[model samples]
Target: MASDPEDRAAAQRELASLKFAQAQDKAKQDPAAAEKLVRESLTLAPGDEKAVDLLGRVIHAQGRLDEAIQVLGEGDGKSCDMCKRYLSVLLLERAGKREAAKDFEGARTDYSRATELIPDATTALAVARSSEQLGDLEGMTRAIEKAVPLIRPEDTAAQTEFLGFRERTVLAAAGRGDVATCDRWLNFFPPGAGGDGWYVLQLRVAQELYRQKKVDVAVTRARTMLGSTHTDTLPANRKTEFQRFLADIYRLQGVGYLREGKLAEADDNFRLAMEFLPGDDKIKLLRALAIGGHHETEKALQVVKALPKETKGHAEVMAILESMQVADRLAEGDVEGPRPRSRAQAASAETPEVHVAMAEILFITPAAGVNKGIVRQLKKSGIVKYPNDEVNRYGEALSELAWAREQARGLGEGYLFRGPGIDARMANLDRQLRAFTRSRSSSTPTARRS
Candidate 1:
């Protein structure tokens, strides 16, 4: 025991300071080596909060985050808000490591804890991204919503960036027809304060509402978006996006309902579709079918009756009129409904995905074959799958599938309804039928070989 207590106290402070300074210098060049100096500094003067925090960081720099967190926690016991919030950064960095490892669940947990502690934009974004990786869409939306208040009201760029992330997720989910996921995201960004995000989300909401057969709600949402004076970041060409996208939804629903023999519903949907695509002949034909199928013979007749005389004389119009007559005649007897599933309906079971992800990540650079982006963009532009593309570079897989299917269908009736030339043959027959009927009366069907 040194008889001088003052000397012992003075020695402890001096050593602690010297060791802490050395630790800082070493940390810049060699974090692992700095760990030793930082530990020594903490021991020289017990409960040195700064030394504890520094030691945590030094260890953390060496990728020992668990230990870093434990070490910092001890200091945090005596520290105030300053160092406590710093811990959230440590947590976020660690979560990134876990995310890189595809330990998404662990990353989500870490981000959740960090965001709960900090409740700020940085941590909230971490939470949202981690949740997206985990496919916890609800969690992702919740995290993004939590970030809204933290964003500066004047930072439109920041607001767009955050909402852009959500939009990607929303559109991707909707493109896959993941209705549950789309609807969950729609719960946020209703009208008001959200600005661009809210307007964009409404587009998806209306699309999904139509998919769900909530036609009125979907139409209302579309009309509201069309009417919104609020501007968004999308290009002006996309101004009619709500109407165009809703038209697609209505057409899809009309096709599905027509297949299901829900003629009345299909009629309404097709009518809604014409509001956006007034010239869509397929929509008009389908609406007539819907009316006739629903037993509205007069309404079904009225559709064809309303067509121009030249149009009424077209084969397509006559066919629809024939369908109406069949419905009227069948009014007296039981007519077997079509099978539970129809080919048209089967197509809508999943939304059409125009272009799949080029690479697992948006950009992948390897010193090898054609870049995935090139392939993806080519496919997106409909340049892939050409007869000349396969066996050379891109679209080899798709070409193989097409060739195999073509070869198999040639082998039997299983593919009787599908093939390359069958469409042309069908079209030829349709043309002949239309040509033959171009001069006939609406009541002058039943042409025979007499």
Candidate 2:
């Protein structure tokens, strides 16, 4: 081997030439192949700086960014500062290693060493975003301030990034109850032109207004947000929530109109809400429509009948439907439907409890509770007493009534007075049964008459 020095030297030169050619070919299209060539060249000549830089570039291109960092890491005093600084930044980003990325002080060291290594707006913006994601708000502010001078006025990306930062800052300030900071942030935004940020800010303001009981202002702000074309900027699910909020606004408006005796307007808004509402409570809108005489009560009942059976509103809605049928019958001089109105009337005519039960079942709300029909039935029975045996049967009815009351709570304040009427009807039913029993005993043959 010592005698073959010339031959070994010739073989090394040949190997170097082959690696250079392979690296050139790979550099055009394949980073992985380029990586292999550069690494091999470095292995043959361990002190070659060119081979090390080329290897770092290839690794960075292949997204093995950490490898690039390690390759360029050895060049501190031996190679140019520019390569090391650029390689470090790229390494941190590609690896999603923010701690390494924010080694800005370290980067500044290398950047200061390189004579023409000017820091640009894009670099600063990226660093700012990284800092923000890492919860380094002070660092973000510093980064943006440094980058601002390099950003041209027309640079849309820079503007957008800055606005996003501003939004986060405002939200953070609001969370901290720093009203002065929030107001400063708000001043940067004009009326309605800032896309989703505009709506978000308005929504926050509306919430504050609601908390302060500024109902009109809150409603106006909520309406403005939902009505904006940029409302579509919200995610599909959030858009649904906004729509529901808008519906709630309409519901409140409907109540206001009702209180003001603007029945037509109240009914219109309630109907509009029902049109957009997602669930079975649309019956409420229809009921409002009926009670307000927005259309004939008959028309509202028709709306109820048109709903599917599985809807949450079905039982109350169907009873409304039945009541309308009765109303229509009465309109034509027929007092009642095919079924008798009173249980005692039916019982006196030898009606079976099974049939009565079947008829009464329709009045039971699915979620449980009393209904106006139950009141009507007990009232017609002329019951005027309450006792232990009767109270148990009545408790079952009251349980059903309790469920109805729960359902009604969402309907609003007007129905609160109806509960007392229900209690009175139960008392009357007990009295009638007792009186009937007493009269039956008195008329027996072994009694006074006998």
Candidate 3:
């Protein structure tokens, strides 16, 4: 009676299919018209997967990405493979536009969604790029990992590009002290894939670790690389550079140990450093400092004196000599007056002799006792001569020690007299200075006496 219900349903389905076919043919040449036809087809058969896919494509072609995405999303509930493929493509296109506009956040959103849909190398790489722009190192690394497996063997260009990206990521990680990330990426490359550049990268990572003050870790990493057979494959210049880098690391460690009063360890590291950087006078000076740290003033003095008179660190060496002489004079209870005809008194001397003398006095003075004669000599040294200077006598002494320490550090000699003995003495002087400051603030100043 109702015009045959079955026949009516069949007619609607046939008409919908016919409209969808027409829409597909016109999709490329006239997307606007194609969109209208697909919409009419969907009106007749509301949930047709093919019809919905065609509508999305036509809408995307007409540059209505948001509408197209909305239309395509309708078929997702039906698990339409074709719809998902089209949607992923549309998303990639939109992502590209966003990226071109420098809207990386929007681009990242689209790229990430597309990656979840297709899991293809191209989309994954796009996600990686966007993540990099956002400073998302973890996201960038994850995307790269996803892409590497998807890359086809025949796609040599893609593989090379991935490797290059990985190399940059590793270096960036190293620079930021992300040791674990650097290690993971480094192991991703097969043996010999990174060539000599690989070894250089390792050295750079170790150097960065050192700069960040992770000294023990840096030493271990550098030592491991130094012992690797792969090192022999490096070019001569690169090998030399690596060797020198290792030497520098050892020297730095030696200086650290020397400053901490670990004489045996300091001497051992310095010797190891000398093996790589043979005849390095800086290392020799460091060894001498180690001797001095152990209170072997004569041995330290002889080592310094043995250096050529025209050494670049002549000023530092002279300071060391003065420091030792002061120590010797203090030990002999000879602080009655300044030593006669000393190198510091010479007209040609350029060393900060006053600072050196004060540093030595501070280095040798026990925490429980203060030498009045040394105090008188310090006052007479004129370290507190500036009227406008706010620091008292003890503060001036500490300042001189600090200046000497900085000079030594700049010359790669480590902090001068940073051993426990000197540290204790300096701490004691600091306490006294604080006490003196409080007293001066609350009471009349004592008469100035030398």
Q: Which candidate has the top score in TM-score?
A: 3
- Across 157-220, the per-residue lDDT of candidate 2 in tens digits comes to 7777777777777667655656565555555532232656655665675566555666676666
Indicate whether candidate 1 or candidate 2 has the larger lDDT.
Answer: 1
Q: Which stretches of candidate 2 lie over 4 Å from their true place?
A: 1-218, 225-245, 252-299, 302-316, 320-393, 403-450
TM-score of 3: 0.63
Q: Between the candidate structures 2 and 3, which one is better when assessed by TM-score?
A: 3
Candidate with better TM-score, 1 vs 2: 1
What's the lDDT for residue 344 in model 3? 41
RMSD of each: 21.6, 15.4, 8.8
Please, what is the TM-score per model? 0.48, 0.37, 0.63
**Candidate 3 lDDT over residue span 1-450, tens digit each:** 147886888888888889989999999999999988999999989978888788887888888898988777654424556788889888888899999999998998888888787788778888888888889988888888788778886766666767777778878887888999999777655223466767777878888898898888887887677676665676677767767887887877776776565779988998999998887887787777777766676787688788876765544655555555665577688876675226543422334433546754543334444466655654455333322232234555667767755654564545332332344444554565556445444442343431
lDDT for each candidate structure: 0.58, 0.53, 0.70
The per-residue C-alpha lDDT of model 1 at residue 154 equals 69
Candidate with better lDDT, 2 vs 3: 3
